[model samples]
Target chain A: MQEKQKPYAYAKSLELFARAAAVIPEGIYGHQNPAFVLPGACPYFADRAQGGHFWDVDGNQYIDFQCGYGPVVLGHNHPEVEDAVREQMAKGSCFNHPTRLMVDLAERLTSLIPAADWAAFAKNGSDVTTWAIRIAREYTGREKIVMARGAYHGAHAWCTAYPGGVLDDEKKHILSMRWNRLDDLENLADGHKDRIAGIILTPYHHPTYAAQEMPAGGFWEGVRKICDREGIVLIVDDIRACFRLDVRCSPHYFNIDPDILCVAKAMANGHPISAAMGRKNFRESAEAVFFAGTFWSSPAPMAAALKTLSILESTDAIPKMERLGRKLKTGLEELGQKHGFRVTASGPAALPYLTFDDDPDLYHIQAFSRHMISRGIFLHPHHNWFICAAHTDEDIDYTLETADEVFPEVRKEMES
Target chain B: MDEILRASLFLKAVLPLMEDLVDFDTIAASAISDKRLILQFEVKNGPSSHLRIEGGKIRHGIGMHQSPDIRLTFKKPELLNRMFDGEDVRPGLRKGFFHLLFLIREFPKLAERLQYYLEGDGKKAVDEKTKNFQVRIGLHAMLGGMATVASDDASLRSIADETPFGTLLVRILPDGPFGTFTKLSHNGGYIFESTFNQPVRHANAVMEFAGPDAAKKLIDGALNAVTAIGLGQEIKIRGLLPLIDKASIFLYRFGKIMGV
Candidate 1:
C-alpha cells in the first residue's frame, strides 16, 4: 500500500455530495447512502467501473468487494451482459406487451431453479417481494405474515428495516421470528394458526452491523415441516445472495424447497430487473395479485438477465467467486490473528461479513475499514461484502497485503 | 395534539430537563447554586410533578412534594400545556407569592434557555461550552421526550406496541453523556434513562458517537445520521440495530416536537 504524501481526500466527491445534499434527501439515501460507509475516508461517488474495481471521482481506484451492494455479481460492465443489453436496446426497450426475451429469461429461471415452476418479472426486489407476499395472502386468504426478525425483505412499508414514515396499521399483521430459531417460527405458526398467510425469509440472515447467520442444522427442515403442517406459504427472498450462492438460487444450495422465491440483485448482473418464481399450484394466486410496474416488460434487462444467467451457468463463475471469497476470508482472519485481533469471518464464502470479538459497537472494524478505504480497498464496515466472479487472485492478494499494514494501526488505535 | 400528552410531556419530560440545564449549563448552574426552591406543577385530574432547585442541583419529584414553597395549579391539563407553549393562560397560585414571582419572571428564562438549546437556536457560531450544553440538553430532551411520547401519545404508543422488546444504548465515546432506551415487555413502551456519565451495559443495540463533536453535529442536525455514521468511527451502531432503527423513528418525532 503506497502512502500518499498528503492525507487522502475526496475533493470532487465531497463537492458533489454537498451539492446533492442541498437538493436531495440525505445527499444519498437508502442502502446506497454513503453514510453506510466511511464518508470522508471513502469515496462518495464513482467515476467509472470495470471488472472487480472502480475509480472514484478523485481518480482513486479501488478493488470493490461491495459489488454495487450485491447487484454486480459478474462484476461491473461485463461484456456479455453489456452486449446483450445493447442488442435488446437496439430492438427498443419498454413495450406494451411482453417481449420474447422476457419469456426466454423466465424459462431460463424455471429451468434452473428446481422450486420455480412459473416466474413473473418486475423492476426491483421490493416489487417482487411485495408481490410474493400479496400472492401468498391471496392464495391462503389469511392476513398474518411471519418473517425472520431483522431480515430485510424489501423497502416496503410493511417490511422496511427503518420505521420512518411507516404506520403501525401497516405492520400489525406482520410478525417476527428469530433467525435460525426453528422453535420461534413454530411457535409463531402455532399462535397464528389458520391466520398465517406466508413466511418470508432471506436465504440467510444478512443484517447490518452484525455477522451474517446461516440456517442452523434442521432449521430449514423444521421451517418446511411447520409450513407444511400449517399450510403456510414459504417465500425465500434471495435478492441479496441469489446467483452468488448458486445459479439455481440459494434454496437449492440450502436444499430447502420454497413455495415462492424472489430474486433481483446479481440476476441481470447490474440490470434493473427482479422476479418472483413460485410453484405451479400458486400461479393462479400470483396472477390474481395485482402487481405491475410500467417497465416490467422492458426487453433490455430481460436480455441482460438471459445472458447473465447463461454466463453464470457456462463459466465457473459461482465456484470462482466462492473460492475467492474463501481466500479473502481466510487471509483476513489470519491477518487478524497475527495482529492480536479476534476476527470472525462469517456467512457463506460467496457473501461474507467480518466482525471482531468484543467489539459490539464495531469501532475496531470501522477503524479497519477506514484504513482499508484510504488504501483504496472497498470493504464495507457494516454490511456483508459481495464477492464477484471478476475479482482476481491479485485483487485478493492486494487486499490481504493492504490488511497486513492496516491491522496493526487499527490494533494500535484500539489500545490508545 | 393531545393536550394531556403535551401536559405529561411538559411535566414529566420537558420541565425535568431543567436538571440537565443546571448540570450542563454553567450560567444556569450559577443562577441556582445558592437557591433552595421547591416548585410544584399540579395539572388537576391529570399528571403532577415538581422541580426542586437546591444547592446547585435540581431534582424532579413526581406527584405532590409533601410541602412545596409554591404550587402552580392548572384548571386542566390543557392550560398547563398552553402555558408550556408560552400562552398567557396563567396557572392559579396555590402558595407563596414571592415564589410565584420567581415562577412568573425567572422560570420563563430557564424555559427560554432550554428552548434555545432544544430548538436548534444555538447551533451556529457558538463556543465549545455552549455547544457542549446544547448537545447535553438536546440529547436528554430528545430521549426523555421520546420516552414520554411513546408512553403518553396514542399514535406513538401504537408504534411502540410493535417495537420488539430490547434496550438501545446511545452515548458519546470515551465517557460522559450517555442514555439508554429500554423497551419493557410488560409496559409495551420504551423508557429512557440517562446520566451525566456511566458505562453502558446489557443493551440489545448501541449507537455511539465517536466524540462530543460528532454527538454535537448529530444532535444539532448539522450532520445527518447517514453522514455521521459514515464518517468512519464517528458514529458506530451495532448489536440489534433494528431496535435502534425502530426507536430512531421516535427520535425523529422528537425533532418534530422540538420544531426542528
Candidate 2:
C-alpha cells in the first residue's frame, strides 16, 4: 500500500479566499466555486500556468487536466499563440476600426469548418450561440426554437441552466426535446411546424456531473432530416467539445454537418474568442441581424486564434491528447480492478469523466479527486477533465503511477 | 383631497387605458383567468379603496374579493401617478409607499403588461420619435436609479463590498437608438458611471445587449439576464466567474426594485 500523502497546505489560498469572500459573493462563482470541488483540497487562486501545469498561490504545482475549464486546448501559454498575441499587441491589441486579423481568422475558420461558408466573431460561446439563434429566427421569420432538454448552448435567457431572473414570456418562444431521442425532436418539429426557427444541440450529450452520452445511432441523421424537412435551422453548439474531438469540427468528426456551428473554448488555445459559422444560405440573414461587440474585432485574440488553428492543423495535438487521455483512462481502470473498485470513465478519450459505479453522492469520486490533487494531479470530481496537447508520455506515466498509489486509499475510504 | 377620493380619481383616469391594454387572450393563455389580483390602496387619513382584477376584467369595490392571488399596495396616489407617468417606481419601493406580492415566477409577465399599459403608447400620448426618446430617457433613469439604490441598500452594499474589487461595464449596443453604457465599480463601496465611450481599464465583466428594447426587457424582468447570457440572445457577459454572478445578482436586485 502507498503511504498516505500529506494534506495539501492552503494557508495563503485560505487567506486570499477569506479576503475574496469578504469582497466577493461566494468567493469564486460558477463552476469554479469551492463548493463544486473538494472544499479544502483545491486552491482558490492560481499563481501561474504553463504547458500542462499550473501553480497555486501556495506554491503547489499541479499537472492540470481541467485545462482552465476546457479552454486550454494546446496548453497554457502556448509559445506559438503567445508569440502571435505579442506580435499583434505591439501593432495594437484593439482598434476603433476592425483589424485585418479578424478577416484572416474568419477566412481561416470558414475554410476549415465544413459547414461554414461565412463566419462572425464574438467574445464568448454565448455570443455566438445567441447570434446563431437570432440569425435563425431572422432567416426563418419564426419565433420558436427547439433545443435538447439538458444541453447548455450558452448562458442566455432562452437556454440558461438557471431561470431565477428569466421571464416566462422570454422563454415562451423556446421549446425543449430530449437529447438522442429523434422521435421527441421530430414530434416537436412536426407539432410546431413552420413556427420552429432552429434546433440546436451539442455534438454529444455532456451534461455536468453525469456520464456523457454519445448520440444514439442515426440520431444525428434523423435530426438533420427533420430540420431539412421542416425548414428549421440545425445549430451545433460545439463550444466545450470543439477542437479536442476534431480539427475541422465535432459534427464533422461524427460525420454530420450542421447549418450553423458555434465554436469557442479551445478554438484559440485559451484566447477569449468565439465564432458563429454558417453555410452560405445564412449569409443574408446573418448580415441582417445586428451583432457587434466593442472587442469582437480585437487583433491580438484573432492573431492568437489564427496561430492556434495553424498549430492544430499542422501538428498532432488532437491525437496526442486523445492518446494520453486513453492511457490515463486505461491506467485508472487497471488500478480500480486491483483495488476492488469499479471505475467508469466516459465521453471522448480527450474529454473524460471518472466516477465509481456505486457512488451516488460522488463520495468515492471526491476522495479519488482529493487524492489526485494531493499527489500533484488536478482532476475535477463532478466535471469532465480535459487533456491538453502539452501532456506528454512522461506526464501520463507519472499520473498513472500516482493513480496506482492512490487507488488503495480510495478503496479504504469507500470501505470506511 | 381624502385618500379614497384621490385613489378613486387616479383609478378612474387609468382604468380605461389599462382595460384597453389588457389583452385578454394573453391572460387566458397565461392560465391566470381564474386568478384575481387586488390593487389595494392604503390611503393616508382616508378609507382604503381596492380594485379586483379577475377573468380579464377589473371590478371596483372594497372587500368584495377573498384571497387575492397578487396584491399591489400603494400608499400615495402620486407614487401611483409616477408609475403611470413611466417614471422609475423603485424610489417608491425604497420609500415604502409601494409594495407588491405574488409568485416570483409570475411577476415578470405581470410587470411586462403593467409597463405596456403604463408607459406604452396608450391612445397616442406622444409621437413615435418622442415615445422613442422617452424610452431612452427611462432606460437612463433606471441605470442611474440602480447606482443610487446600490449605494443605499445594505444588501446590495454587502454584495458590492464582498465582490472582489472590480468594475462591471454594461454596454447597451446599437449606438443610435440607445447609445449608453454603465460602469459599476466595487472597491470599498460602489460607483456607477454611465457614458458612451469605452472605459480606460478592462472591466471585470462586460455585459453587452442589442438595443434599448432588449435592455428594457431585461430591466423589466421580461428577459432573463442569465438566459440572455446563455442564449446569446441580446445579451453577453465576459469576466471573472464570481464577478459575473455578482453583477447578475446586482442587476436582478435592481430589476426587482423596478417592479420587474
Candidate 3:
C-alpha cells in the first residue's frame, strides 16, 4: 500500500469507512463505538502503526492514547514482538492440544506472580472473568456471584447487561456492590452470606461516570476481610489496569490476594489472549469449565506474551511509563488550574482520566474528543486513556503542550 | 477563534428542514426586528435569543436589544467565540452565567427557533472547507416567487425537468453519489414532504416555498417520507438561520430535493 502520515486521523478513517461499511457491519470489526456515536461518522481505517504512533490510510498520525482500548502495551507492533510472532508463525501458530510452551508459560507465571499458583488461558478478558465465576459457582456451589455496582467484567451476555436496566437474566449469579465504598458493600454482603460466590471488582468502579477512582482508605483490605469471612471468592478484574499500574504481580500490590485474578490487555501486545491466574484451590475446577476457543492457544501470541512480559519487567516499563504519565498529569492539572475551570486528571501511570472538576457535560467529552480528533489525536469522550510503552517523553510533552494551548479555548465554551 | 461563519453556513444548510416544520415566514413577521441585518430571535418558551451579524458587528436584526438585555446578557466577544466554538447557551442561562431568562410560555415558537439556531451555529466547531458551491430555492408563495440562493452564488449547470411525482420546484444539487444532481418534478415541491440525497460536498441553493403551511406541511411530510435523491453539484443552502420549525422544514426540503 502507498504510505501516508497518520492512519487513525478522522477524515481518512471516514474515507475508508465509506468503502468498508459496504461489507462489514458498522464498517469494522466488533461493536460500534463512541467514534460512531455522533451524528457524523467515525474514521474507517488504521493504515499503519509503530511505537507510540499510528496512521490512518488518509495519512494522519496520532500519539495513540486510545491504545486499542487498553491493549497495545509495548507500543504498536514492536519489532521484537513482530520478530517473535514471525518466528512462531513459521513453526505454526497453534496445535489442537496444550503446547509445551503452555507449560513454560504457566510455570513462569506461577513463579512471577504471587497469587498465580494455577493459571488458565482464553482469548479475551471476558473469558477469564467468566471462568472465575464458573469456578466460584462450582467451588462454593453457590447460585449467585456479587459484582460491584458499575463494574465491567467483560462482553459476556451476563457482564454487558449488569446495571441501569431491569435485567432479570444476567443479574442472577451476580449480586452487586459499590466500588471504593466499604459501607455499601458490607450492607449488601450482610444480606447474602453464603449465597454469594464471588465479588468481581475493577480495583476501580467499571461502568459509571465515576469509574477509574482508586479504592480509598484501605477499602480493598476491608472487602478482602469481608470476602474471607463470608467465604466469597474475590475476583479482581485487572484486565483493564493490569500492566499499566506497573504491578506485574498486581494482586500483591494492594496486599489482598483474591482467590482468582483475571488479566488481559497489554498482555500479548495487541494479540488476543487473556489468562486467569488463581491460588492453588480452584485451578482444577477452572480447567474443567467449558472455556475453550479454537484460536485460544496460538504459539504466536504465546511467544508475544513471553516477550512483552520480559520487556516490561526487564526494562522497568512501568516506572518509565509512570514518569511520562506524571509529566502528562502534572501538565493537565496545571492547565485545569490555569483555566480556573473545574478540571482534574486521575487514574494510573499509563492511563489518565481528565474531566471538569465539578460539572461535566457529555459535550466536553464530545467537544474535546472531536477537537483532538480534528487535530489528529483520537480522544474517547467516554473513559480513561490508555498509555502504552510506546509513549515517549516527547510524546507526553507534545500532548501536554497541546493541552496548554487548547485549554483556554475549551474554557471559553464552559458555563463560566 | 473558531469561525462563527462556518457555524452560520452549517445552520443555513440545515434550516430547510426547520422551515418544513414551522411557518418561519409567519414567525419572522411576528418578531419585531430592529430592521437591520443583525437579526435577533427571541424564542417563546426557550431561554435563548439568537443574534445575526452581517458586517462583523452586532447592530440589530433578529432580536437585538439596544439597552443590551440581561434577559439577554452579552459577554460580547466571549459569547460569540463560545457560540462558534460549539458551547450550549441553554445551561449557561440556567446557571445565571448566560443570564438570559425567558418565561417558558412567553416564547414557545421562538424556543423552537432558538434550538434550530444553536444546532446550526455549532458552539465549538472549527470551520470546514466546503467542496461544492451554492444553489437557490425560489419562493413562489410571496411576491411572485423570491429567488433564494443556497449559497451567496446560486448557479445550476443542469436540472432534470421531470420528477417522479408532479410539477415541483426541482433544484439540481451541485454533486451527488452518481456525480449528478437532479431537480425532479414531484407530487410536492419544497412545501410537500419529500426526500433528497446528501452530497459529499457542501452546496448553496435557493428555495421557493409557497406559504407558511406549505413549509410546515413539507416538514411533516418529510419526517414520515423515506426517499432520498442525490445532489449532483457542490451546493449549500444559505440566507437562512436556525428556526426550531426551520429544522423540521429543511428535513422535507432536503428529502424532497433528494427525492424523499
Candidate 4:
C-alpha cells in the first residue's frame, strides 16, 4: 500500500526514531522541539551542508531558513569563511594570553558601530547583557535597572523576569518602562534619578511576539537626553539583530549612541559567539569586569567570525539585505492584500514578518505561520521574520505561492 | 485558616499519607443538619452534594434533595477515562466537547459561581479573566490581581473567618515563593500577582489581587466616603486569599442582602 510504502521509505528514519525513543525523550535532540521540515517531524539528523542548503541523512535538499536559527546569514560552509577556518587551524585558535585578533576585532567593531569603542566578548548574548548591567552599576553608583516594556535582552533573571513573576522580589533591581512612552521614561528617570543605574533597550522594538513597531517621534531622543541628564547608563543588546539588520542596529540607527552596546549572531554564521562594545571611558571598567568562559574563545568561531567580517567588509552585505528586505515586504504585503489579510514587515534584514490584522478568535498569524511551515519554507512563526541573505528570490516566490494558496483556503474556512 | 472553613469539611489535610481518601458518610453525618445537594450526573451518584448557608456560613446538611442552590455533576466513567488517558482538561474546552446544562436564573449568584467552577481554569476563561483584570486594573470594582494589602495578624485571624479565599489558604504556610499570604480585602484596594495557564471562568489568569487589603485601605483611608458596603460601595475588608492551581475554595456571602 502507498501508505505502508510511504512509511517504509521512512522506515529507516522510523527505526532510528523508535530506538531514540527508547533512550531519549520523545526521540528528539531538544525537548519540546518539533521538527517541521520534510517528512513533517523533528529532523532525525543532518549529514552535511554547503552553499545555502543542507540535507538530512535521507538526502533531502532544502533551503535552510533554520540557518542555525539566525546565525547563517552567509549560508552553510561558505568557502572564504571555510578557508579562514582552515588557516586559523594552522595557528593556535585560543590562548589564555591576549591575541592580536581580539584588539583587531574590537577596532573593526568600534569603526562599524558608533558606541562600541572598547569591547568585551561573551560566549552568548546573556553574558554581555548581564555584564552591561554590572558595568552600569559600576559607571554610576546606582542600583536599579530599567527595561523597555516587553523587551527581552537575554535569558538572565533580570531580563527573563518581567511584569510580575519573572523577577521575584529578591531579584528586585529591574523595572519595566514603556518602550516609546516618553512620559514613563521621563517619570522613571526623574523618580529614580538619584538611585537609577541604567535603562537598557533593544532597538529592534516590539520585543514580545516581534511586533516590530518602530520607535516613534522623539521617544529615543528623549530617552537619550534623559539618560544623560539623569546620569543613567544606556545598554543596547543588538546580539540577534546585529548582522541581520545592520551594525547600525545600534543607537546609531536611531541617531544616538549608547554608553555600552553588545553584538553577536551572524558574526560567526552559526558558530556560537557574541561581543560587547562600549565607549572608551568604560574601557577602564572592563578591566574590573570579570566575564569568563572556555568555549567562548574557541578557535572555530574566531576563524569563522574573522571570515564573516571580511566578507561583510568586501560586499554591501547590509545594503543588499535592505533591498531584499524591501522586496520581501512588498511581495508579502501584496500577497496579503490579494489573499485578504494584513501583513506587518520591518527593517531590511533576513527576517521580515507577515502577520494579519489582530483578531482573537482567528489567530490568522498563527495559521499563516503553520501554513509556511507546511511548505518547505520553514520560518520562525512570528510577526517579524528573520530573513537570511541565503534566501534567494526563488525562495521568496515559493513562499509567496504558498501564501497565495493558503489565504484563499483560510478565507473560505473563516466564512464557514 | 479562618474559623468557618476550619469548621467545614477541611479535615482531609491532617490524615496520614496512606489514608488519603475521606469517608463522606462520616463527614456528612457529623457536619450536616437537614439536606444535601443533588448530583445530577448519572455517573457521580446523584443527590449527594448538600450544604446549608446560615448567618453567613456554609455547612453540610442531612438527607438528599433533587434541587439545591448549586448542583455539580461528573460522569465517573468519562472522568476515569479522561484521567487514564491523561487528557488535559483545557484542550477539551477549546475543542468544544464538554457542556454545562443549567437553568440560568433559578439561582443567579450560585449559577455564576458554578459557571466559574466548571469552566474553572481553562485557557479561554483564564485569558478572559486576565484581560478583564488588565483592562480594569485601576478600577476598584473588579479584581485586577493587584490588591492594597496590610499585615495585621490579629485582624486577618478575626476578619477572614468565613471567606473562601481565606478559608483554604489561611493556615498552611509556604516557606518559599508565597508565605502567609492568605489574607485579602473583600472589596479592598489590594494588589497581588498570579498567572493562569489559560483563562477559564473563575480560573485565575493572574492571581495577585488587591482584595481585602485594598478594601481595608480604602475604608481606613476615608471611612466617611464609605457609608453602605453594598454592590457599588466596595466592601473594604480583612484579607481574602487565592487558592493554588489544582485546588479551589468556595466562598459565598450569606443572606438575601449579602452582595447588595
Clashes of each: 0, 16, 113, 59
Off by over 4 Å in 3: A1-9, A29-44, A162-167, A206-211, A414-416, B1-260
Model 3 CAPRI quality? incorrect
Give the candidate number with the greatest TM-score: 1
User: If ranked by lDDT, best first, what sequence of candidates would result?
Assistant: 1, 2, 3, 4
lDDT of 1 at B13: 67
| Model 3: interface root-mean-square deviation in Å | 15.8
Per-residue accuracy of model 4 over B116-181 as CA lDDT, tens digit each? 422234444345333332222112211111111111122222122322243112110111011122
Order of models, best TM-score first: 1, 2, 4, 3
Model 1: per-residue Cα lDDT at residue A416: 91
If you assessed candidate 4 against the hidden native complex, which CAPRI class would it receive?
A: incorrect
Per-residue lDDT of candidate 4, residues A342-406 (tens digit): 76665434566554664322235545554554444455443245556565677666666666777
Which 10 residues in a row give candidate 2 chain A its minimum summed lDDT?
A: A1-10
Provide the lowest-lDDT 10-residue window in model 2 chain B.
B90-99
- Comparison by DockQ, 3 against 4, better one: 4
Query: Which number leads on DockQ?
Result: 1
lDDT of 3 at A15: 51
- Candidate 3 matches the true fold with a TM-score of 0.61
- Over A1-416, each residue of candidate 1 has an lDDT whose tens digit, in order, gives 33343235788887787777777887888877765665567788899999999888998888899988999999899998899899988888877898888778888889999999999999888999999999999999999999987688888999886556887889899998889998898788878889999999988899888899988888998899999999999999999999888899899999989999999999999989999999999999988988777889898988988989999999999999999999999999999999888999999998999999878756788888888888888889989999999999989998898899999999888689
Candidate number with greatest lDDT: 1
Calculate each model's fnat, 2 decimals: 0.30, 0.00, 0.00, 0.00
User: Candidate 2 at residue B10, lDDT?
Assistant: 40
> Per-residue lDDT of B122-152 in model 2, one digit per residue for the tens?
4555554444444454454444344434443
RMSDs, each prediction?
Answer: 4.3, 17.7, 18.0, 17.4
Computed on C-alphas against the true complex, the DockQ of each candidate is 0.32, 0.02, 0.02, 0.03
